[model samples]
Target chain A: MRLAIMGAGAVGASVAELASAYGHEVTAIADSNSAAIDPNGLDTEAALATKRASGTVGDDSPESVLEAEYDVLVEATPTTLGDAEPGYSHTVSALERDRHVVLANKGPIAERYDEVRAHERNSEGRVSFDATVGGAIPVLTTIDDIGRSNVTAVRGVLNGTANFILSRMAAESLDYEHVLAEAQDLGVAEADPTFDVDGTDAALKCVILANVLFGGGYALSDAAVEGIREIPGAALQLAAEDGQTIRLIGEVVDEEIRVGPRLVPETGTLAVSGTQNIVQLQTERAGRLNISGRGAGGDETATAVLGDINRLL
Target chain B: MSERTDVRAHTVRLELDDEPGELLNALGPIAEHGGNLLSIFHERGNRTPRGRIPVEVDVEATPERFDRIVDALRQTGVNVVQAGAERYSEELTVLLIGHLIETDFSDTLSRFERCSSASVAEVSLTVADDATDASSARIRLAAHAGETDRALDTIREVATEKDITVISPLTGGDAV
Candidate 1:
């Protein structure tokens, strides 16, 4: 399969390398930063160097990811709402050109949910975002497997930075600032974690999950977001005193989606502590199913992106 | 590097029933109020470790429209768990010890979020320097000023509950 990547950042470059390894023709990669992909393929060592130099290697203007004349396009720009100049532009171009789309970025897909789906319908091109919600975990794929079932609700520790901080804080009784600072040092949290800390990142993820599994377009503004910042650390300890832990969770019911802190009972299957994401599914048929995994490491996210490229090929 | 004052964004979480068109029903308010959508993530196949899908979203709009969007969304008969601009104001870090792999620690970090004027800023792990069960990670957290105390409180609680050891701030916020 001939392939191109919409961004040359961490996930994008990783996808390119994976495609090359699987013997797929990764024709072109776009990023104003530096050319990570060529007609032959990406230089894996060079990409790693770039990743090391800059945490990400995305181009503000990435026209090449779209104009590559490839069979498939993988969009992997950093997610942000209302700023889809390159990714959105490239996605539409790919679909219009009659190429399949493998979306790893959530910003544009979440915003233009119906428009892209419409394009897929009219153009008869397949589109999938299995890597958008879960990093290496099969959350989206699993949802795809159990399609068309009415999902009662969703609750999870969708964001890793906050959960890591909370876990440390709960255990060490450290202050918030110290934990976050350490997280930055560890390269887990961003310099400005406005989205992840504030709950927008997880919210966007929830939107994708809901749309893909539950069906229909969702208004992101309507989803509730409660960051871990305001939750009293004492509250978590109180829960702990009772053999429980506070997880910043996202919950979706019939007409509403919720995100905030929840006191998960320790004995329940849902009560997973730390960076691992645990999911429960309640289908009328299956009753309830549990899924858990690593949510936000670079390797994990990159691995899943690779899986998508492999599948697409 | 956008203008914070002019840039209006909100984070919200809601409790919705598992019914048809529930997602569309929730989104109606944002569109009706003229809010520009950013992103939406939904975990549908799996439950909330307890049983429920947690849908998250990011949106942009005027302050007035933002209020309307939230109002309209709640009016759609969904449970609005929490809402706000969610600004962070503090930071901290700590280390953990014990057998993390055995406890399914991967699921542990995923349960927390960057709220409370805080965020998980960093993480460093010593893999027992071997495959043996002993491993440790030093975690960093950032939150609103003075919120570090609460954040540390949360970590200590989680550590005790999970049976992980907390290394130290050793000193205070100044040390970090």
Candidate 2:
């Protein structure tokens, strides 16, 4: 299979690493540099080498990214609406050219799900963005297959920044800033960390899930967004005293969606033990399906990216 | 697109007292005049030198509803510093430079709602690998006829408060 990646971020590079390992041809890798500056877009081997050399990735060079035509296009850019980023054009362009798509990036799909789905309908394409919403939890597949229609609601400890901070607060009694810095250092959180700390990331992820599992496209305004910055450390302490841990939760009730930090009793399943993500899928038939694990580890993300690529094959 | 001769949208720059309930008070008129709330992204944590928080709200209402929302906000003792309607001729594009992944780029879009008149037609992102860094974006701000410039201006101002850079085509070969 010939592959084309739309972004060169951690997720994108990881996907490249996996698909290439499987003996597929990753023809091109792209990023937001409209200039197309670097000539040699890093190959999987080269991507790993680059990361090994500097402990960071360097792919999406102009020459290597636009190397050749591809059998598929992978959407791996960061999620944002409108002209704020790159990859939407690359995805649409590949679709227009009749390429299969595997999406790990959530922005275009979330912002223009209808438009892109229509594009998919018109192409020889199938999409799997399993890594987008649930991170390493595979909530999308779970919702799509195993525990689907019987599902009632889902609550996510979606943002790693917020979750990690909460975990550190519980374990070391650390403040938000210190834990946040640690999260960044661990490469589990974004530098800005606003979306994770805020309810925006989880809210958007909920909208994507809701649109897929539920019906009408959710109104962002209707889906409340409250970041974790305002959540005082003392609040977590109080929750801990009550045998609970604070988790930023996103869920749909009746129709209205809730996104905020809440205290879950330690005895309850929803109470996250640490920064690891815990997603509860409440169903009428199956009861509660709690998906818990390390949500943002690099290897975990890479493996999920590989999983999406396998789907492409 | 619901474009009326009477109602047009303008960017309202507000210096909200860094306190709770202030946002609710500021939003009275917007909801009252049937000013369909397009989006309101309050930088609750980012305070101005005056110790007030900056808030940028985009509304899609008829001219009357828009004015009423503005008026309502003022009447509630909410400080309304700047207000002007946006008239656009072309849909412009721009890039946002910052830790977009870190900033929850999704919330930024939540601040941009969709209405029959104008909405965010498209969006894309480029995340860096190291993760302790900034990403760039190319956004297409699609708006009603003669409303593009104002939309761009409002979005740029919102980016400023969030500490993100806006890269776009020049409007009128000058700042709006």
Candidate 3:
């Protein structure tokens, strides 16, 4: 398979590395600033080395990568809300050119799923975005396997950073700021951390899951999102008095998608600690199916992206 | 296929004014909402603190039909005390030892009640001679089939937060 990856971040770079080792041709690779393109397949090792040393994949612009010959376009750009630009435009262009798309970017699929599906409808190439929701957990694929009609509800502890902070706060009886700082020091949280802490990340994942399940063209803005920012230590203490532990849970029931700190029995499957993610699917026939794993990492998420590429093959 | 194939039995408690035709009036709404009556316990001699007659009605209907029955009862001004008695197919027993009363035993019990797949079947609490001393509670929970582990997990979670020790039932396979 000939591949073009638009974002040279951790996920894109890792996919380029793994797919090359798997014998796929890396035809084009691009960063926000520059791009490297080769119709005969670029050298994956040389491109990564150049990115490490020169801070750009190559001097070729992003437009050139979109124009280059490729069988599939891997969208690994950073997520954004409105229009989901750059990533969205890149995806639209690839699908228009009759190339399959596998997304590691949550924004485009989450914000403009209807438009992406419309593009997939007109093109010969389809879109696969297993990494968009649950990292390596295969959530979307599991829903696919179960047949979407059997799935009643999809809920989970989707954000590892939020789960880490809440789990530490509950165990150590510490305040949010203290646990968040500890998480930051351990590199489990980004420095800014607003997206994870403010619940937008989990809400976006739930929105994507909702669209996949309901197919009613649900968008990120349609979700009822609440973060753990205002949760006080005293609330945890009070909940402990009632034998309940608070976890940041993202749930999608039909068209309603919500994300916030919810009181879940700590012994339940969703009460995972550290940087772990869990997805639970309520099915009409199979009862409740729970799947948990590492929700993020360059290589971990790239594993999902590569899996989508293999399915395409 | 019959509509009764997936029907479940649910019990609803009602508080009615001690009057002539109150029981008959309440039965009308249940039958009108397509519920088949299983049994009824109309205690006319008993009076609640509010001086109302206590009645328990058991009816069989699908979940959606049951919802409509409860709504119709409320809309018609029938004082519905409790909507439904949660039922489950399997049971598990666990002993919780700690400051059960101090940490709010009712709250702990309600946590079990809140789980959709599990319900508190019965509870027995024992307190030490000294009022301030520790206590223990034997809790029996009814859960849906194949969901005992999830129910036990909920109990374990609540016990952990309250600093209580739990002795759970033998849940076969991987005892360790």
Question: TM-scores, in order shown?
Answer: 0.60, 0.58, 0.67
Best by TM-score: 3
lDDT for residue B110 in candidate 3, whole number 0-100: 62
True contacts kept of 2: 0.00
Rank the models by TM-score, top first.
Answer: 3, 1, 2
lDDT value, residue A184 of candidate 2:
85
Error of 2 at A182 (Å): 3.6
lDDT of 1 by residue, A1-313 (tens): 7777766666776776667666676766666454444555556556556656884443323554465557778777677586545667667788888888887888777777777788888775678777777577777777667764655555566787877877877787665678889888987788998787777877887877677655657757768776766443444554455455556677666656667665555455655556677666656576666777888665677677667666765
User: What's the CA RMSD for each of the models?
Assistant: 21.5, 20.0, 13.2
> Who wins the DockQ comparison?
3
TM-score of chain B of each: 0.46, 0.47, 0.51
List lDDT for all candidates, in order: 0.65, 0.65, 0.82
Model 1 residue A15 distance off true place after TM-score fit, in angstroms = 1.6
Candidate 2 lDDT over residue span A1-313, tens digit each: 7777766667766776677567676666655542122223435566556555665445335434433567767777777755424656656677777777777777766666666777778887776667777777888888877645677777767776677787777778766777788878987677888877877878877877776776446545557665666444544554455355566777765666777765455456655655677677777887667787866655566566667767776
Residue A80 lDDT in candidate 3: 89
Interface C-alpha root-mean-square deviation, candidates in order: 15.4, 20.8, 11.1
Which consecutive 10 residues in model 2 chain B have the weakest lDDT in total?
Answer: B167-176
Docking quality class, candidate 1: incorrect
